[model samples]
Target chain A: MAIRWIALRIIQEIIRDRRTMAFFLLVPIVVMTLIYYALLEDEKAKLGVVTRGVARFYEYPLVSVIEEDEDIEIVSLDIPDKETDPAELDRLIMEEMKKGKAHGILYMDQQLLSERFAGERGAIHIYLEGSRPTSTAAIFSSIAEAMDDLTETMPVVIDAECSAKCANSVNIKAIEIKKHYLYGSEDYRLIDYFLPVFPTFFVFFFTFIISTITFQRERVRGTLERLLIAPVSFSQIILGYISGFIIFSSVQALIIIGYILALIQISFTPHQLFALGVTLFLIMIVALTMGLLASFMAMNEFQAIQFIPLVILPQIFLSDMIWRIESFPLVFQWISYGLPLTHANIISRKVMLQNQSLWENWPQLLSLGGFFLFFMLVMSLVALKRNKNN
Target chain B: MLKIEGLTKRFGKLTAIDNLNLNIPEGLKFGLLGPNGSGKTTLLRMITGLIEPTHGKITLFGKWTPTSRMIRRRVGYMPQQTAVYPGLTVSENIRFFGRIYGLSGRPLEDRLNDILELVELGDKKKEVLSNLSGGMVRRVLLATALIHNPPLLILDEPTAGVDPVLRLKFWDWVDLLVKQGVSIIITTHHISEAERSDQVVFLREGKIIQQGKPFDIMKRFQANNLEAAFVRSTNLK
Candidate 1:
């Protein structure tokens, strides 16, 4: 009952604070929306569709969808009817691809469009620029969908598979994907890769900041001393802070994840969403404890901000949230071994993508739980020591 | 209710409190009078167990070392700062501090009303502490301290910055507490204010230069008032 009241009081205090409410509840979504558009939104994929059948290509049903995509600039290069050599047409497309002007190319067989071959099924060839694998993959799939629309009359051959000689094989009717995903389906987008980890980062960052400054303010305003003189124990105080702040932090994580999902349309099963929510709660608990421990060292709000560089930045730089962790050097990689976010990022991604349970991801859960317990113990010690006015 | 002997707190070369000895018995209104940096706060902090003494033998209620929780609950301490939560309303702050000291339900609500009446904050129960006047916030602080109804009340400079009318009201409540046999220990630099205590001491550099009733100290120093008596006691010593 006592712990409940303390927790309730803290929640009431934070809810009543307008500045804190704006930062925790409002700032994250606004900034996250900006980041979603800036980093993940694909507004500039260039695919060169090579075909003398310029008018025929516009007949593709998905052409309307493709045209509405302002991110992709489709420069239709005209080959001179059946008179132009097929090899010359493909060579021109490859030339444009090498210049990096087009990330992908679609070569429509001129013979298939001519009257002589009109009775026979036409074939289309897609060539993807090799520099950026993800962008190359996205453009390839988009063209595949466009050909899937035209597959009833024409056979589409990817650049790597079945050369132009096999394009007219009337036996095969539909597009065939030679490679399959071991994880997500071919329909997955680049934004899907980060859905799991971004939620964790958002939760950790906001919770760390709000918890630190608010705890420091408790000391600055002298309420900490007053609390010390109460019958409340140190452990109870830490528990109260955790219970108080975690309620809102969990809501923040869910709100961000839900908003991003609605905007980006990444489908998740109820089980996956639940796992994400649970993992976020665990990470938020870690952030809360870590923040309280740091607050003990800070005498003022500015000193609390000093912890951002000292702790938060280092954790972010070393974690997989920024980039692939393997790209980091040996010493820097070793730093991530100690940082709990590394484990959290890995675990959240696995849980959301692989549908791993708490037991399946026990090692990561143990590491994150260990960090949580370690910080909690340290926070208790710090809170107990600092309770007495110095 | 309190005892001290050889109580000394030294910050390296600087001794903040030195060889202080005093006894504050039950039902007595005691005051420690000193100028700024005269170790008044340090002395009060040590007694409240907010900070441990460097070298001292101290006892409260026959126990030389009370458990931390006991020390917290047995003494109602109101510091000079407005320790109430500024974001919380009067009723919320009252209930919060009361809950912290293990008060709740009917008894808690009753004490909240009683404390608001005592502090004369009966109408401001719904107002946030930050929006309250300085004197009102101080009253809220005192209400929180007194919420648990601890026998010993230690108010550190309670009326220091409060308006004159509020200070008089605060003293009137202190008189009521004394009549109820609640042991009260107050610290202040206001010599005239310290004169009303049953026993008062003027400390300098952590050492007691004057210890007696206010009138007796005035007679001993041959001064017309406590301010003059206080000036003579510290300067002469």
Candidate 2:
């Protein structure tokens, strides 16, 4: 009965606070939408083609075919007489990339053009701006397609009139680029690669903030003291609060996950989806316990909010959500290991992207459970101490 | 019934309640009156088990240190801060407290209405607590304290912000509850309000300066009112 009332009051309070309600439900959608557009892959790649006595390569039918077929914009650059030095040409390419005139520069010099014509091996150098990797990759692939086209059709063009000796030396063969995906498909974009982290991150963040503030309000307003004086045990009160927060936090998680899946059109099997849900639920539980424990250290709502940087931001930066934990130093890696979000992110990515089952991620789930239990125990001890000191 | 012996509470070097002792009989309206910082609320908190005493013991209903579930169920505590959910309506707040105290169904609804009517907030039961006036909020707090109908109700400054007319009504309700054998432990700064209790204890710096019936204290101090009696007793002039 005590748990029911506590949970009911929490739900009512959150529902009635219109601003908090919007923050809980709508903020995630807005943030996810902005991130989606921010990380979206560009459809067109612009290339600056720098040629030295190989400008005729740009006029080939195959180059035009690739330009039209792959949605690539190829701009031809004339090599100045003074730019004959490779260092000067490199400076010119860097300048073009810095000016945002192209995503990448494709440099095909006289030696490479002559080698292609003479049926010998040739290498084309491509310089990338390196800031926008997705577009740079598109530019690189478009140029590679054009080169492959040239390789395939060069033999046919020479076979009509070349002698048998020239034909025998023609070793220009198209590099067969067979693609395989170990995890995701070739059509997967940046958003799909990152979709699994969004729901977990946003849910964890917002739930933590809300729980901390709400619990702090209870303390400041003396409702917590009143509860402590009531017939309910201390553990029951904590359980009640946890159950209370879980209701809305779960709803928030569902909305975010559903919105991402629907908006990004990512597909998962029913079993994989269930595993993902379980992982998210565990993350939500950890976030709630974390918030409750943080509230114990804070005296008011402002102080509770102050905990975001101390408590939530480190998890975001170090949790392997944005960066790989393996790349971090040993100390930071240990910190990431101690954080619950790190485990949640790992489990989420595994369940969603790798199609791994929940049982396969038991260690991470157990770590999350341990974090939940630790937070609950510490929060209870704090409550008891505060009660005694009241 | 509640009993205390050598109840002393200390915070670091400052003693909030210093070597105090008292005995409150059942079915009596007991008042602890003092100015701010005199430790009236601190004494009430110790009795309600909200805080631990550094050097003392509290016996409630013949049980020493009544932290058990049975003792908790028999006691209802209303802290000084309006400790009710501001976003919830008055009835919702009462209902929540009722449910927490193990009241439910028809009995809960009936008691909810009874407490709301008793507190004279029946018309405002649907109003959100934050939208209500301060006095109405206080009334809502009192209503929640009374919702479970505990044998002992400890109210810390229950009528602090209530209007004169509503304050009188609150006393009348307290009188009715006392007549029904409900033991009341109330802390208040209003000396005249303490006159309504069966016995009042005036605390000065955590020590009892005066304890008796209102008229008897007034007679002993040769003052016409309890406030004047309190001033005379404490030499506050």
Candidate 3:
């Protein structure tokens, strides 16, 4: 019963400062927005199409063929005349590339029509701005698809027959490929892979900071000494702090995922939403208790800040957010598994990508349970030691 | 009443309190007098159950063991530093301290109003600790210490910043508490304040050098006053 009062008092102290409101709510909204927009880029790569002596070539069947690809959009840049210098055209295309107005240039030669009309080989220059990776890949694939449309459709003449009856021997088997996705559609963006882990990282990062500093401040200000003299027990103190952060972190996770759903239009099932919430709540509790343990290791707030590099930065580099956990070296992979954030990242990704049921996530839940028990035990012991010291 | 036996506390190579024993009776104001780094505060902390002695037996009200919840609830401690949370208002702090001692409902509210009035903070009850003046904060600290009305009050330098006139009224209040059978243990540097205590124990180097009433010690040392008597009792002379 007294735990509620303690937790409420702590939350009251934290929320009294306007900085908490801005940092916990506004800053997260802003960072999540950036994640959404950064992934929104390169959905369609614009290709600049330039040509000479091809006034009627735009009417060719390949124009509609290339435009049919959803990933590529062609922008026609008129050449001054059929005799216009190729250098001038190249300069115009380069200028467009520099301004990010186009991903690449597909320069059509007059031979494009003549070669097809004569049943001969035809060549066109595909100049790509190789510096832009995502857009460049999409543009390159679209150019390949445009070329295949003509090659794959042509009727093959067996033994180079010139007679109409010989054309009957030609085999033109219709080939169509169908693709099915397990998780998402064919047009998956980088943000789809990235958004799953963003909430976990954000919750871990900010909650780690707040919990460490809040507990450290209590020690530095001598309030913990006062509290020890009260009837409150060691476990109650640790439990009180965790409860307070649970309230804040739960709200933070909901707001982040809710904002993503509203603005970025990421659909989520109720089960997936619960999974994300549970993932966040478990990690936040771990961070909160770790912060409590860190308070004993630090004498003041500055010392607590010093812990960020040793305690927080390692989780970022090694916690399987940017790369696969198995991709790490053997020893580092072991270390990643040891850290609680790794499990949190996995649980969140499973929830987001696979919509995995909460009941199926028992292994990760057990790991978190172990972590909670360990941190709670250590934190209680240290707090008792501190009470004695004070 | 409290009795401490063979109490010793050592921090690594240095011993802060060594083999000290004393008996404190009910309704007595015992003054622990010592210089800095002496064992006065350490003794108070052990008695209040905030820290454990390296080797000791403490008997409180016929109970053999210390650091029990009953003992903690019965003993109120006000440390030298300003211990109130700066974010909480004065009334909030009072109610919190009251609740920790299991005070609730009308009893908590009544005690809250009374402590606020006694601390002369009736108008500032709604004010946060951060916005209060230093003297006001000190008043609030004392109010928190007195809220639970514990049987034993352990005050460490409670009158450091208060003016002389308020200090007199503070002692009058202490006298009232003593009359009500509440044992008061205070540590003060001021010799004049030490004279008001029914018993005085001068400690140095984690051991008591002298223990008696101020008048008895003064007469034993052939000194004119308590201050001169303390100087004559110590090795400084």
Candidate 4:
């Protein structure tokens, strides 16, 4: 009964604070929306084709074929016949790329054209402004598709003997590239691949911050001392707070999950969504307990916030969010395993994207439970010590 | 009733309470009088089990220590700081402490109303603590402590910032509690407030300089007021 009252009071206090409410509920939605647009929205890549000699005759057909792809835009650059310096042409292509007029440059010369007509394997030289990996990959795939189309529909202007000989020697579809997915489809964007991790991280991050600051404030304001003087035990206090924070954090989790799904327009099975919810709930408990333990070490609100770099930043960097944990060094991989977020990310990805059941991902789920227990145990010990000393 | 034997508390190199011994009888208004950092709060904290004594023992109502939950329920402590949550309504703050002491349903609500009336905050029970004035917030803290109706009440500077009118009302309320067989342990810097206590102890540098009935101490020092008596006992020219 005492625990229930304490939890109720905590809920009342937090609900009355408008700024904290906005930060807890609205900030994640706004941040996730920004990430969604930044990662998934693709713009058309412009390619500048420099054709010299006989290659100029292929430019119109090549551009027409590549332009069929919505993601690629082809621009034909005209150069005077006398200005045949390779360095000059290369400089011109580089200038176009630097000016942002083109994403890549395709150079097709006489030797490459004759080789193609002679039924020999020809090489196409392409220069790319390769700053962004996604854009670079997009440009390469579009050009590869355009080349495949060119081989299938050769220009009628080609000599009948050469065309017939080249067609007889080369199979039109020699390399049929087929795509098959074990889980997600070709329509899945980079953002969709990363979406499951965002809510897990936000739930953990915000809960930790709010719990730490609130616990620190309770200590500094002398309410904690008053509580100790009451009949309530330290464990009850910890449990009461956990129960209180869980109510709101659960709502926060639901908001983030619903908003992200609606914004990204992705559907999941009810069972998978339930599994994701369970993973996030466990993550919230771990975060809340960790924050309580941190508050035991902090004397004031500023000191509580100072723990962010020490506690939260490492989870962000090593939690397999930006880089896969398996790809990390052995030492870092071990550290990632120790963090609560790494387990949460792994479980969330498996359940949401891989269509895996919770039973199949029990190891990671068990690791999260372990982290929660460890944090709660340390927090109880610290609370006991603080009652005696402070 | 409370008894302390060789009670001592040290924070690293500084001894906040040193070899302190006192016996507080039941139903008496006991005042701990001291200047800043004189260990009055530390001694009260030890007696209330807010902190463990470095070396010694405390017996509360025949119990060996005051840390037991049953004993904790019988004692109420109001810290020097206004320790109420600013985001909660005044009624909510008082009711939370009441509920912690196992009061519930009609009993909790009745006690909540009684405490609010005693603190003269009945009309402002719905106001958030942060919206209240400093003195009103202190009253809310007092309400939370008094809401439990413990036999022994330990208040540290309960009327520090209260206006003169409400301060008198607080004394009246303390007098009423004592009259009802409640033992009150309080610390205050206000000399006049200390004069109302049945017994007062003057402490300096974590040691008791003088202790007895307020009138007896004044008489012994050949002084007209407890403040003058306290000054003479501390040897402050």
Best by lDDT, which number? Answer: 4
The parts of candidate 4 lying over 4 Å away from their true place are A1-168, A326-328
| Model 2 per-residue lDDT tens digits across residues B106-210 | 999999989988888889989999899988888888889888899999989888877898888778988988988789988889889889999999998889999
User: Scored by Cα lDDT, where does model 3 land?
Assistant: 0.75
- Single out the weakest 10-residue window by summed lDDT for candidate 3 chain A: A173-182
Candidate 1, B1-237: lDDT as tens digits: 789989998776889999999987899889889898899988887877667777887898878953367777888989888888989999899899889898889999999999988888899999988898888888898998899998999999999898888888888899999897789999988778777788898999999999998889999999988889999987888
Task: Give the Å shift of residue B121 in candidate 4.
Answer: 1.9
TM-score of chain A of 1: 0.56
User: Per-residue alpha-carbon lDDT of model 2 for A66-153, expressed as tens digits?
Assistant: 6775557776554464576778888777677656577677666676656555555656677765433355567657767787766655
- lDDT tens per residue, model 4, A282-363: 9998998899888887755655776765678668767877654544446766887899999999888778776779878889
TM-score of each: 0.72, 0.75, 0.73, 0.74
Interface RMSD of each: 2.7, 1.3, 2.1, 1.5
Candidate number with the higher lDDT (2 or 3): 2
Per-residue lDDT of A156 in model 2? 31
lDDT of 4 by residue, B120-225 (tens): 8999999998899998998888888888789999989988878998888788989988997889999998876788899999988898889999999999999999
Residues A250-282 of candidate 3 have per-residue lDDT tens digits of 888888887666643356898898888888888
Superior by TM-score: candidate 1 or candidate 2: 2
